[model samples]
Target: MIVGLLRSLSAKVPSAVPRIALTMKPQVIFVLGGPGAGKGTQCTKIVEHYGYTHLSAGDLLRYERKRPDSEFGQLIDSYIKEGRIVPVEITINLLRKAMEKTMTENENKFRFLIDGFPRNLDNFEGWTRDMDGKADVKFVLFFDCSNEVCIDRCLERGKSSGRTDDNRESLNKRLIETFLQCTRPIIEQYERQGKVRTIDASHSVDEVFNNVKKILDKEG
Candidate 1:
């Protein structure tokens, strides 16, 4: 399904839009965290203050799933409903297209806050191989929070989020299967390279963003 989706989308993409080449490396900072870790909130603040384009992998997939006449709509919906990560290729292709479109529309340098991506080793490896020289990961911002807190936050959010995975059942699968089994390894991988900055997400939104701003300030 993923391969077919990629081919179909590639065929539809206009060849006129230039692809990112080896010499043009965009600035990318990965935002990693479990569900309800406030990644979205912090990313909004970063975008407002740092002039970075915010790209949430989940949001990209969700948008594609809802597109009219989308070939991968059903497939994307199924994976999302099961709390499974979408195939890395599909996500990366969407991201690359988005980045290209954004860059073409604006004159500024491309600095992106890529939220909720490279969720596992497979995703990490796929991104490294596919984007090898087209983009560089400056750092990973990890929002650290206890599972219990995350669960509560997700459940509370589910009351109004309207997101399929915001409920308890899906949140459980996402927290354990995706975050613990998959995402944790990716965070550790970046940590080993000293490219991860852990932020305490149990605090108020303002407090959390304060820490995030400090890190981004230092990065700048």
Candidate 2:
């Protein structure tokens, strides 16, 4: 009689469980790679194809450094030269400001293809407040290219950047330092979540953009 009662209670409790449905907030794609990994090129494709608002943190930082009296301008310049991510609070503030601008200007119709902002896990943690705990990463596109290819491209684009560190030694050091200190675990974290998408970037610019377009197309 006790066994019969126990079985009946278990059956009732199973049906009484709450029926929770999963809902995803808007998708945000972050493009990450070493310098000269064609992130800007791919960002252009995403913006053109899917109407994503492109926020290039490097460009923002570069512009800020041009102002002679800008606070943190010199520090930002030195950090970029070393291929290191800026302090978490500074980057988070910049990102938040950009996001706010995009949302207001677009009336919340904009999707973000944030380029080169979050460079470490701490940045990721800081971003949680923005999402209100309902944040879901659509994907992390890692532009996988060789250091040799990156260095070559950086040198060829000298007219635009006019940067002394665009040369072979500094470029190589940047890439090596980025790999050693930044990318490995971040890649692994996204891989564990099944949100990492990689593209072979040793191709022509058009070819790489084509690959990027294919990935962003899925969300549209």
Candidate 3:
């Protein structure tokens, strides 16, 4: 069912885009976690130590929403304000463009820490078709943190973060609808493939990254 959806969506990509996607083979590490699960924090550490490009799906969406003439800006803003996941097609297009741009500019091997992506089954399917066999997901990094802890962290960060979705109202929806309902199944799928590396994100920043560093060092 999901594969069929991917196949259907693949035809929607522009003719020239697939050629670019096919040529830019990158080592992709998907970073998955709930809101305030420290995905961004850990991704920064991974980038500094491993030289991987950190592409946060949330950041990409936020930037696109603020872009001067983006066609998806209003639509993205509505979904984000409601704490609903954006459509997979839009998200994957932004991700693929970012990956292609980075890969084209750099002569070295491309390694990407794609944070908070493949948020649901549709996202996973879209990514598979969109990349056109160029990149393989090396593994998924799942940051395990309790909802109570996550909410507290988000609230603290919200005081200064200025992100609309960081408040209590949207956090509730994101925690339940986005994380539990959508993301958990995606993690399970990767777990079945033996491609998931779980990290305890309930700890201090240093402690969490210590665990992260170990995994990256061993994996890379």
Residue pairs in collision within model 2: none
Off by over 4 Å in 1: 1-18, 21-24
Model 1 per-residue lDDT tens digits across residues 1-220: 7667667656754343346743346789999999999999989988988899999999999999999986778878989999998877678878998888787777485899899999988889989977878888999999999999999999899889899888889999999999999999999999999999999999999999988889888884
Every candidate's lDDT: 0.87, 0.69, 0.87
Model 3, C-alpha of 204: deviation from truth (Å): 0.5
lDDT of 2 by residue, 72-130 (tens): 66767777777666655555556556666556555554477778746777767666644
RMSD of each: 2.8, 14.8, 4.3
- Candidate 2 stretches greater than 4 Å from native: 1-26, 129-136
Q: How far off is residue 44 in model 1, in Å?
A: 0.4
lDDT-superior candidate, 1 or 3:
1
Residues 1-220, candidate 3: write the lDDT tens digits: 4344445545654442434543547889999999999999998988888899999999999999899997667777888999999888778788878887888888464899999999998888878877747787999999999999999999999999999999999999999988999999999999999999999999999999999989988996
Q: Which stretches of candidate 3 lie above 4 Å from their native place?
A: 1-18, 21-24
RMSD of 1: 2.8
